[model samples]
Target: MTKKDDHKDPALVSIGSMFETGKIRKMYTLAELYPTRIAKSLGINYGRYMVKLNHPDKFTMGEIVRLADLLDIEPDMITKVIYAELN
Candidate 1:
């Protein structure tokens, strides 16, 4: 099976497809428009934060909200990406 078929998570596949299609590029750009400078202001470690939220680390909704705020994007966008990957 191809990698897409191997992926059990449709949301993740969807997000991946979105990226492959360049749909997420703007969002990614927007998210990173501000560097770690903002994260530092919030006492957040950018890489560690992503690892915590995206992988082994569990992130609270509040933390997600804080991240969204720091990234200057709606929390829903992040949630949508996650939910898309999960469901």
Candidate 2:
């Protein structure tokens, strides 16, 4: 049987690798998981959601918690990424 990845387009895999550095970016996570749906769940428009993602420090405590729940990740994971990016 062919490996699942064997069917993947080489060009697409190469481009995907370019974005898969060890560090995970918040925008990438949100974008990959459907930003529009997330924005609606957060009661905000896509533009505002994008702005908040671009400026991590602008996120409120409730938003942080809600995002963690939505993303199925620990709250600290999100905070750490934001802190690391800022520092």
Candidate 3:
């Protein structure tokens, strides 16, 4: 999504909640899950990752895919992360 739509997306808000809770995994910090090389390549450097973590709509699906791979988490989990908190 574009910067204009970043905070307007509800799904992004939910994902942000997941990130904050560390419910995505033990390593919620993107830096901890992947090194500088991968994070940078994925366009999710430390600073950007923090921004996306706080505002998930700022993340592209490609970036999420990259992070999932880095964390060894199923890509589907990224979309459904909020369910874990709901249930």
Candidate 4:
């Protein structure tokens, strides 16, 4: 499937919901999950910047993709909420 198709898949949609709902604890418990690197690369600290950005409120698809990339997740994993707005 194309990348855009993956973004519209139900599974990835659910994953993005986890992010939107602040269920990060569960998601981050996975050993492979790591968003800190992306945050650092972007010169941000997830905790501080999230608070600064008022996360769960101001998140954009582009921002989500950047975070997902840092966490080694596919952009689709974090785009469910912003996809409509993005398109």
Candidate 5:
């Protein structure tokens, strides 16, 4: 996906919603618990996109997978968590 196409993905809003409502804080906690794997799991873009929030964290559904792996949960659970918070 090109840089321009990123803005078009609904997953962008999903990730943004997770962050905005503080749900991503749990993902952060899981990352913290497994600090050693942080580098491989989060990588450079995690920081880059976090502030700008356009890092394509949802690109290829990677963020959801990452959160699921890190939290010892499922990707669907991540979506459910973020969605639940919205309501």
Candidate 6:
């Protein structure tokens, strides 16, 4: 059985509206996704990107800002991840 709602275009729907309707987006971690794409965005090779991901302390402040922007996450989150090892 088809309804009027079935005819609606998903692309026309806003992300906020989807959230308001109880449809939440799944959040993924860096490790959960392939590193190649992120590496390409950062202009680094996969191997070196993986090294930075593992040892975040090696990242400079500029890199951290760039990473946060690239990942669409807050810089504090990256900061926490980098400093989490100390505590």
Model 1 is weakest, by summed lDDT over 10 consecutive residues, at 1-10
Q: lDDT tens string, model 6, 1-87?
A: 112244433332332233234342221235335467666766788888777766667777877666555544455655765675435
What are the runs in model 5 whose C-alpha is more than 4 Å off? 1-40, 49-60
Which prediction has the highest lDDT against the true structure? 2
How far out, in Å, is residue 7 in model 1?
41
Candidate 2 residue lDDT tens string, 2-76:
233345444333323333442465544555546787777678888898888888898887887666555444567
Query: For model 5, how does the per-residue alpha-carbon lDDT over 44-87 read when each residue is reduced to its tens digit?
Result: 34454343233223333676665445444456665654455444
Residue pairs of candidate 4 with colliding backbone atoms:
none
lDDT of 1 at 81: 57
The sequence of per-residue lDDT tens digits that candidate 1 reaches over residues 29-80 is: 3244343554454476777554554441255687666555544445566566
**Which segments of candidate 6 are over 4 A away from where they belong?**
1-29
lDDT of 6: 0.53
Q: What is the C-alpha lDDT of each candidate?
A: 0.49, 0.62, 0.51, 0.47, 0.45, 0.53
- What are the TM-scores, per candidate, against the unseen true structure? 0.44, 0.65, 0.47, 0.37, 0.37, 0.58
lDDT of residue 22 for candidate 6: 33
Write the residue-wise lDDT of candidate 3 on 1-87 in tens digits.
Answer: 123333333533444456545556423343344346555756646677665655555667787676555444455666555344334
RMSD to native, candidate 4: 8.6
Off by over 4 Å in 2: 1-23, 26-29
Better of 1 and 2 by TM-score: 2
TM-score of 4: 0.37
* Model 3 lowest lDDT segment of ten: 1-10
Ranking by TM-score: 2, 6, 3, 1, 5, 4
- What are the RMSDs of all candidates, in order? 13.2, 8.4, 12.0, 8.6, 12.1, 11.0
CA lDDT, candidate 4, residue 83: 46
Q: What is the lDDT of candidate 1?
A: 0.49
Better of 3 and 4 by TM-score: 3
